[model samples]
Target: MPIQPQAAKYKPESPILSLGEKIGDPVHAADFPKAILRFRNDRWAEAVGLDHLNDDQWVQHFGRFQPLEGTLQQPLALRYHGHQFRVYNPDIGDGRGFLFAQLRDHAGRLLDLGTKGSGQTPYSRFGDGRLTLKGGVREILATEMLEALGVNSSKTFSLVETGEDLIRGDEPSPTRSSVLVRLSHSHIRIGTFQRIALEQNSELMTRLVDYCLTNLLQPAPEGVAPPIALMRQAVENTAELAASFMVAGFVHGVLNSDNINITGESFDYGPWRFTPHWEPGFTAAYFDQTGLYAFGRQAEAIHWDVAQLAVSLRLLCEAEPLIAELEHFPALYQDSLITHFFRRIGLTPGEREASLQFIESCVQAMAQTGTEIDRFFFDWRCGDPRSPARYAGEAWDKVRMEAAAFLPAGTRDHPYWTDDAPCSMHIEEVEALWSAIADRDDWEPLNQKVEAIRRMGEAHQPRLT
Candidate 1:
């Protein structure tokens, strides 16, 4: 099946250039010599006004490094420094990826079309800047599951299987190669600020802060400094994002500074996993030997990343104000957890204290019984009577009863409520899906899984009061 280009409606924008010298040399994607279009996110393309691109044009732009209509003439390989695991590393940037283009969605939010495994750049030190097909597939699955779970996450825009055999130490040798385009809110990361701070370029730091305040963030109140304002917004949004990850049972594997987008959206999905049994120590990355990014420690990890952001902002603002803003993360994260958890369970907003109690009781029950995280929500959604009562002790019973009172009347008879189980992206299921692709070159299973995840997303769409 050939991909057809859709009539593009929105024009591209390059606001990042406002921070001069922050971005690096121009780079072209690898001429993989083969372009096999494996996945195209038409639904998202429609939202971004690129649904009319034909297959050839799609390959030309995304695969062959040709510029999209009204987009960047040449991709920019962004430069930045990041702390891989609490250790600062200066030799890190878009080694295998670059910011291909930027455009606005229907709501006028700025979005970036960035590439992975596209080619090597100045940042591609001691590595063949390419992405494994398995890595691309895993990222698509991760983003799909996160979006369906109501987490603000990047969407896998397009995936092309570049016909090449690459050897990797992590997976089986001679694995297939691919190129991926991710549509994200912004490519600006915490490390972007870190890089400027490292250079002691306070002028550029101020410019970057101003750019983010004017473009990426909400308008600040009168008399509020842009750096302080940006830090506050980042704290709030990062807290909300961390809570969403918790409620979704996701472990991001690596919560490095570079991976933490300044807009607070979840991007750069690698070695991510959904919790199987709500275990706190569950880890996604095989290299995470110290459990620094374990399931339970995600909030801690994100808070650390935000603190690093505050450290960067100190170049433009006083440490006292920034420290005060950083102090808000703990409470904000707790409040957001309660809010997102309620939203996930399909319950109308309740008193803050009540919501907290409900979440605590549910967590206790799940921990005691080892209930599957997704299944617990699936069975107990809207206080369904058919849900397991074994773990519904007196405290949880009251919680459920209260939650039942807040269910929207419109959802009482929704057909999705009657489904036996919620759609889940467990590791075993992910392995099975990948096995079909690897063993027989069958893609039907992956397609079916994505459709099922989408249907579940539709089912979980919150009902209006």
Candidate 2:
């Protein structure tokens, strides 16, 4: 069946407006010669009250940055300073994107409709602000795979192929262009606060802190300062996010402060890759020569970014409390890793020590056999008896026994689990998907891949709470 967009049913709200001067800059999207709607996440749109928008309306709102009714009149290109690769750069903000609107999900949680490749902004530096069609397609694949794996991630709400030929030194010249809209919990990054701290604007900092606390974080204790409460929440959320990435076998190439959102949902899919094995030094981005954001160092990168958030919070609170909050990251990360690992493997939670040992054994098994990451999870899920005999060795035997006791009764009844191969998003597969689109204009492969991923997600019912 051909996909069609439905009417606009927008319910807009704007809490970030409290930042006033720090909110963003007014900007318009480029006047592309055409707006070809390539992807529309109707499921997620329904959750955010946008399921009714027809195709033309979808292109108008997402492709042209036309504000939704009752939302901000003009798109706001948010301003912030970030530490890119450990170097502070003040001239960084929404170079190619802006917050288009804010809305609430069915659960009443605030969500942001943010754009990428909308157009050049004050922070565009010296380059054209447009996203390559390949980049947009890659992001859709990344988000879909990550979400299927139960990682807290942003949804690629819309992807429109804008009519433009872009020249880039990285890829083939005259590549197609696109505009992408991502639906996330928040677009506010740690760098947002860093910018206020850098300017020594204590009053604005206080307002921002309070606003975040009121809008984003859960209610604080009776008398704790909002900054302290927010710090603790950010630490836990960031730690959990890192654990999700580790368990999902995902390496987010860039872990800059600007890329780390305070809300803890993973976004900004740049050079991301899924690990094929237990290789620690598997870096995603080609320029990450130092392996600073490697698969193994992902947790460290997140901790460093969270610490930077704490440093910014210091502008409004004492250092000791924030330091204490930072100290919680290791334990938080470990616990979350174990929990998420068990969830991914379809095992009920076990004793902390036992779970950690089981994870270690699984890693060793993968290393010794060189099995694909997702294949391991798929085969061993719920301790399925059909896993390779070699995987039933002494170490894995113990894990199987432990996991069997907790396996859900109807595990094998699911058609997805019975499949011979697991859904994987390795780089080769990603490139193949793109090649089909670029060379043959065949989108069927991408559509089929998404359907398979969705089925995999459905089979693993009740995603991590």
Candidate 3:
């Protein structure tokens, strides 16, 4: 909106420009019927030096999509292809969203501000490029909850209610519309590589690999091929992501290769649900009849998606090296799962084998007794530093003794730890909150829920690393 805005804290960037036009399309944002600023992520906005905008400016930039100073002169709707439900599709890309801007965050990490329902691009094939207000709300909740549980998730940057009526087969007709923006480390998807490799463009793939190594990841260690280092990083990052989802009891609902980011941050929420208990086959999307991306199979699904990345990387280097790094996913996931569980309960990891057995026993107890997963984590925070007594006849008895050997962790002194119940976002709770906004236009419940989630995050002292 401004050629050179007022003094800002973070530096502006357009690093994606270096990749050239092959990566995306230069596009314009749709002029909305109305620009109603429904949500503003001040916490993260300030980090990216965007908190300087007032309400009107916020709507003008995010809702109307004006070019931000020192960032992209225009929006870029990116291009890529992916496997949707294991069926490879080559025609899809950023149909509804585009990379709007980029900047450094408070932590000095490069961040991209991308949008959903901003407008239609050449990629918007066979469908309207609009996000329902309900979809926007759900994404906000999903990201907030996942972040609180220590998952590496994109922050829901902004949501602007665009006054438009849209008809959809999935939900009732004449639903409201909105634009959602997400702050993420990268918009580079595994599908991006698929598109490049599918073209047999090894040179292009090499350029991308170098780009990721320079910006998305730390420099490759001496004597290591960039492709090999990328495989190792993606594998470990993806394993940690899957493990966090398991520990948080989150069901992403969609595990397509296009949905998976090369940086391993989870975004693009749709038909997501939080499980009530440890149901291994619990499905989040109603259409997932096969339970391919079910609660328990998430790790396996992510591992498969990473394998596709390996196939793409085959263009750049020998498959042997990629396969070698890919082979580490299972063990990396196990370690990540145990590490996340221990962090959830405010305990340090002790023996690797012991931690593994302890987490499994806890899961077994959850499945058999039907304890709400969130409550279990909340109740057990800082569980007796001394060896907890074994239950006379309980599944968690062995787990209790095993956890006792690990020291307590985290700043769990928040009053939230003493509450009668934990802050949880099961599907029912989500629907009830949405009901108020849909029926009476009351947003208080949604506001309060976000605050509660934040408090829970503070209690856990979530580690972004």
Candidate 4:
């Protein structure tokens, strides 16, 4: 058994915890007088102030979603391996996190609600599974911010400031620790399946595949063989995810196999950021010196990760079918990227090819000019093409001039292409900062932009070609 020695230690406790209880059905908001847990003058300690929480309080705050009908919430440690920076590190696993169990959300979606800083498990090899407050805040921002941007991502359901003190080597001495509860489709990753595949445990692999298919994918035809179908489905989901990241200016920071999910939703917001400028070599990870997972290389990185999954599955079946599915990645990602990019600029399917070409050219020019990424699109939502030309401040006029020269010959005819009127927003350097699009915080302006863009999207036509 190649399974890590401690792998078998993790198993769900008695009276399996269901997802329903965790979400707190018949949900009642906690009242001010209820005397709820509070972060001691600090949120990190107050959120998970389990010591202060009585049995009833725990039930009230976390009980409805607890799934288990008891005092102990037994966390299960998972086993898996991953390739960090293109190098295989079999010693890896949850090493820290645990699946609290699945939860059915208000929408009747089976969401896996897990905690990153719950506690140390067998896989916590030399490191604390505890999460810092900084990480907690970042994850919250990611979930709320990215969702508003129309990107599919794991949501931060709750941040229980575990009320405990932690010592993280990265930050200031004695970093505050808190539990970040994330709600997602499933916590299982490509690494989970890979582990079984590596062991050549076809039986376990088959069971795992079936589980993923039934839980992650929809009802399949009765007679269809699931393993191969599961692989194909994984390819499609992963490809779509890759495309979303590519078009959204998101660099996942880490594309490790353990981080990839069968559900294809973007989860685990670690060191993630929208590229500030269009440097193909820009990466979110501090340690990513070679930029293996750079902004422009995300598509390729994901494809490479998927290819690893494909090879791992080779033990159970021929490689050709898997290769075929993998081969479809580029096109799938391209279509997704184009769709997202079109939406960003309010392009619909009915738009003429020339119009789109103009938009693409404008985007390239803005990015090349090192313009902020988010504000540019947000400004475009108001139907301004030559808006950049009206910018009044220093250095901006130069960029505006460049934009004009970059515009295609007939772009002036477009309704948004202004010649006479200046850009409506103030011409301050702060305003200039917004024009580049990337500088605007992903949380702000993005939600408003999504709504306004949707309206334009209604009238908009996309590329017929």
Of the candidates shown, which would achieve the greatest lDDT relative to the real structure? 3
Candidate 3: what lDDT?
0.88
Lowest lDDT 10-residue stretch of candidate 1: 1-10
Q: Where's the lowest-lDDT run of ten residues in candidate 4? A: 1-10
For 232-298, candidate 3 gives per-residue lDDT tens digits of 9999999999999999999999999999999999989998899989998999998999999999999
Clashes of 2: 4
Candidate 3 weakest lDDT stretch, 10 residues: 384-393
lDDT of 4 by residue, 1-465 (tens): 000011111122222133223211121111112221212111211222223445454434432335433322545556777777888777777655666655443333455656676556666678766676557656765554455445667766555544456776665656545566676777777777677676777876666666666666765457746666777777778877786665556788998888888777789877777765556787888888888999888888888888888887786778887888789887777666655555655544233444445445555665656765555654554234435553445444443443343322122233433323312111242233333323332324433433333333222222221
Which stretches of model 2 miss by more than 4 angstroms? 1-9, 390-395, 401-410
Cα lDDT computed for each candidate against the true fold = 0.84, 0.85, 0.88, 0.56
Screening candidate 2 with a backbone cut-off below 3 angstroms (N, C-alpha, C), the clashing residue pairs are 6-52, 6-53, 7-52, 7-53
lDDT of 2 at 307: 92
Mind sharing the TM-score for model 4? 0.70
Ranking by TM-score: 3, 2, 1, 4
Q: Higher-TM-score candidate among 2 and 4?
A: 2
C-alpha TM-scores of all predictions: 0.95, 0.95, 0.96, 0.70
User: Which sequence of candidate numbers ranks them by lDDT, best first?
Assistant: 3, 2, 1, 4
Residue-pair clashes, model 4 = 32
For residue 210, give model 3's deviation from the true position in Å: 1.0
Please tell me which model should have the higher lDDT, number 2 or number 4: 2
